[model samples]
Target: MSLVRKFMTVGGATLGSRIFGFARETLMAAALGTGPMADVFYAAFRFPNLFRRLFAEGAFNAAFVPLFSKEIEANGTDGAKRFSEEVFGVLFTVLLLITIVMELSMPLLVRFVIAPGFADDVEKSSLTVRMAMVMFPYLMCMSLTAMMSGMLNSLHHFFAAAVAPIFLNVVMIGALFYALYTGADPLTTAWYLSWGVLVAGILQLAVVYFGVIHAGMSIGLKFPRFTPNVKRLLILAVPAAITGGITQINQLIGQAIASAQEGAISALQYADRIYQLPLGVVGIAVGVVLLPELSRALKGGNLREAGNLQNRSIEFVLFLTIPAAFALWILSDEIIRVLYERGAFHAQNTAVVASILAIYGIGLPAFVLIKALQPGFYAREDTKMPMRFSAIAVTVNCALAITLFPHFGAPGIAVAEATAGWISTVLLFVTLLRRGHLAWDWALARRAALLVVAAAIMGGVLYYLRGVFAASLASGSPLLTKLGALGLLIGVSMIVYFAVAFLIGGADLGMIRRNMKRKASVEPPPPADL
Candidate 1:
């Protein structure tokens, strides 16, 4: 398949999952809102998620993919399969042990991590700790899922891994609905959602396992032995793990500090979820698919192709992300109100979350670009450089959070995040240019600039139309008014953006057409001779 098609496939699946996740969050907001229950649930959920990123997605995948790709390229399929089994054995054992320990010590971990938020409120603090303990085992299941996902991605089997996360949202939403139907209290419902995470993780792992099998690969547990390849993976993974861990630690720090201020953590979490929709759809999809492709190309000395891929990835990101950022900025309040302004989520909650969402919107493109750029370094086996840059970014993030939290509260943390994101993007771009891994193609530059301009036009049109519709709808029609206003605004903005983008040559619609016309233009070379 062409790069665009591959991205669409993965991104389309991810988009489904994100939409379902939105529904899940919406239900949670209606049930719990931004009160103590919401705080405890968000805190509990974040604890396991932080570790999942640190161990599974962050450290292991970065190191494992390149090595696994190399083995498949050099030693063939059987050799790569062997390598996978050994690594899985050790990883499984280690994660199982860690989960037991974490489950046992969940209270202490929560106390240290989110203590400031619960400083005086002993009841909420204790609840958060207990909930976190209930959810801690999710880390083990998701870690294994990540390992399976990496294996499937290496074989270009992106569908199962991409689609597996949808189950998470599905299960969680079902559990929440069940709790509500059963007349459970809000805290009881939150606890059920926490346990649902463990269930979802298990389902995700099973889905990916079957996907691997259908793709003609077998993975199983075997005696754990440290081969030279495993040793190299560990060596590479340690630093990468630290890098990933530190980035999460930075977020944790922000969350911890924000917790001290009432509702700041929950506010930050809501804003983050809004921004994450686009980030997951565009940036992460590109990163996941591009990294292994780039690694394979670089290993084969195809620097020109690698550069072209990098350029295309950047173009693709700009095509989607620029418009998304503008839309989020313009429709921040509408988006928040539509999705989360029901039940306990009041008008004041919407206003505060919308403010943070707009701030994050300004940095959405930067965050996505960071994902696109980092793979260039990772594919070349230079994990340390990105780690160093990440350290600088984290330091900036921490200092800004500390300095701003005293004055702006939760919004201050949002500002700090945006600032850190831009700083990291700048550093990554400069390094890529200096190292000659990427260059400024004037065509790509012109197209990106035009995309921004078109998005601005869309934003302006939507802003004006929202006012017109607001005035047209009377005060008594609250539900219809909000829905009508949002629908008209989105419909007009989309039409304008797409029409302008096509007219101004902001996106390569023609290239996409050609790619579709010639379906077999670039076939895989017989699975790398394995």
Candidate 2:
């Protein structure tokens, strides 16, 4: 597939997953609300999900993908298969051991690591511990799934791996429906969601495994062995893992701080669901597809090509993310009201969540820019710098969150997190610039400036339109009217932004159209014999 095609495939799948995620989260809000149960269930879910992201999505994949991609390019499919199987066996054994230990120590883990705020309430604490134990095995399942995804991504099979996350949303939504129909109590509902997470993990792993096997790559377990290759993988993976886990680690820190305030955890989560729509689709799609492409360019000694690739990736991230950040910042309240201010969710809950969502918007561009820039390090097997950047950012987050939390509550956590994100982004940019790995040409710089101006114009238009529709978006308005008003604002804002951008030469439909077709128009070279 062409690069743009690969990105769109993954982006399209992620957009699907995010839509399902909205459904799942909306149902969660209706069923649980911003109550103790909502806090408890999200807290329990966060524990296992933390490790799942750390091991699977964050560290291992960063370490694994480049190596796997290199293996594919160097030794063909057979060599890559041998390497993958060895890593899988060792990974499975280690994960199994960790899961057993954590499951056995569930209460202590929950008390100290996951959610200490719950310890004051015996009922809540016990429930969280139980649910955490039931869900802890998901770490093992998802870690395996991550490895499979890396393997498939290396083989250029992006669709199956990217779409796998929809499994979690689907299963969780179904569980919520079952809870509603059965008239389950809050704690019972939490149990259903917890088990749904584990089931989803297992199913997602199976889905990716099927993709690998169907590709005629049979991967059977071997005895755990740290071959030279395995040792090298670990050496690279450890820091990359830490670097990859920064976002989750900071999130855990935020939750730990938020847990002290009743309903604060749920507020953050509800806002996060909305924030992930842009970050997951545009930012993640670019980040994932760029690494392998950069690795190939650098490996072939194509520095100019790598520079151009990085430039385009950054442009794409900002092109999409900047406008999203502006809209999220401007219309967070209306968006929250239209989507979530119903059922068990109240106007007060919408206020807090909207504020947090707006704060998160401040970091949106930085978050995606970090994603775009980090591949400069990862593709070079220089994961340690990103780890250092993460370390600094996490320290900043903890310090700021603690200092700010006393008066501001959840918004304090959001502010701290966004600040830390910018710090990391700045550190990455400086490092890349110092190494002469990335630079901005005048056209790139000019366009970026113009895009910011266009976003401001769009934001102004949104504010004006919002005032005109203020009555329709009021708390007591009918759901359909609120939805229609919000939809109208969004449509007009997008139209204004693109039209202004095109007129000002910040963006060109012609260029985008050409770029999209550029990949499809080129014919592939015929395969060669060795």
Candidate 3:
């Protein structure tokens, strides 16, 4: 399949999952608002979610997928499955031990890592510990689920793994609905949500587990053993984990700082959910497909092919990311009011969240660009370099957030995160070029400049439309009316952006269409060393 189609397959599924995630967030906003319960629940949830990314998707999947792909190329399906079985045995044992330790240490973990702000309020701190314990087991389930996803992606089976997240959102939505129907207290509803997370983890694992089975690949467990390959995976994964851990540490810093102010953490979480839509669709989808493809290209000594692939993926990301960043910035308040300013969530909360969203939007492109660029390093098995860059980012984030949060609050932390993202992205780009691996040609550079120009034009139009719809977005207006106005602003801005992009020669719809129709004569590749 072509790169465009591969991205679409993953992006389409991600889009569905994000839509469901929106529904879930909307319900949670209505149910818990920016109240104490919402803060506690979100704080607890962030712990396991952090680990799920750091270990599963961040380190394990990154290391395992490349190695597994190489194994398949060197041997075949049977060899890959055997390797997976060995890895699985080790993965399960480690996860089981971690889960037990976390559950047992929930109170201490909550005290230090999750909610230092709740230190004065014993009741709140206790509730947070309980929620964390309930959600802790999710890490184990999702870790295995991520391995299944890596296995499927390596085999060119994107649909099942990509779609599995829908189950998670669906389960949470159902739990919220139950809480609403029963008129449960916000604290009780939080308990419901925590349980929902655990159940969804199981469902997510099951969905991908069945896909692995259907692929005619088996990865059954045996006694834990660290073979040479497993040890290599561990070495690769450790540096990658530190790299991934930097982002989580930044998040924890933000959350800890935000926790000092009641409702700030919840506010930040809501904004994150909004920005994640485009990030998930473009950045994540492209990164997922790009890594293995680049790995294979480089392995086979197809330097030009790898360079072209990198350029095209960057183009795809910028075309989507730039406009998204502009729209989110211009319509931040309207979008927030329309999507979340009802029930217990009020206009004041909307203002705070919107401010954070706009700041986050400014860095959206960098976030997406980092996703496209990192695979260049990962594909070459250069984990240590990215780890060093990430360390720099973490330093920037920690320093700025700590220094600024006292005066600027959550938006300050948002600024810190965005600043750190650009730092990381620029470092990655410079490293790639200095290493003679990848750099922009003049033609690509010109188009990237044009994309920014086109996005700016769209931003101007959106600013005017925002003024026109100002009254409709007023808090006293009906929700349906606000929704209609916000939708019109977004839809029209999209049209304007695309038209201007084409006229300025920044993009070609016809070229994209042709590319979509064209297929590469290769399947998703196995590892190069293989």
C-alpha lDDT of residue 509 in model 2: 74
Model 2 steric clash pairs: 59-241
Per-residue error (Å), model 1, residue 7: 0.6
For every model shown, what is its TM-score relative to the native structure? Answer: 0.93, 0.96, 0.96
- How accurate locally, in lDDT, is each candidate? 0.82, 0.88, 0.89
Error of 1 at 413 (Å): 0.8
lDDT tens digits by residue: candidate 3, 1-530: 98889999999999999999999999999999999999999999999988888888878556888888888888899899989999999999999999999999989988887888888899999999999999989999999999899899889899999999999899999999999999999999999999999999999999999999999897777999999989988988888877756666788889988889999999999999999999999988998888888877776666777887887888889889999999999889888888998888998999999999999999999999988998888888878899999989988999999999999999999999999999999999988999988865787678788989999999999999889889998888998898899889889988999999999988887548634653333435456684
Off by over 4 Å in 1: 242-247, 471-481, 508-530
Better of 1 and 2 by TM-score: 2
Of candidate 1, the 10-residue stretch with the lowest lDDT total is 515-524
**Candidate 3, residue 95: how far the Cα is off, in Å:** 0.9
Question: Which stretch of 10 consecutive residues in model 3 shows the poorest summed lDDT?
Answer: 514-523
Q: What lDDT does model 2 reach?
A: 0.88
| Residue-level error in angstroms, candidate 1, position 213 | 1.5
Tens-place lDDT per residue, model 1, 1-530, is 77777777888899999989898888888888888777778887888888988888877667888888998999999998999999988888888889888888876777777556685788888888888887788888888888888888889999999999999999999998998789878889988988898889889989989998997889889877888888888877766665655446666888888778777777888888888899989887888888888888887777777887788788888888898889989888878887788877888998899999998999899889987888888788778887887888888999999999999888888888888888888998899989999987898899889999999999888888767765533333476677777777878888999899988888667645633342322323334544
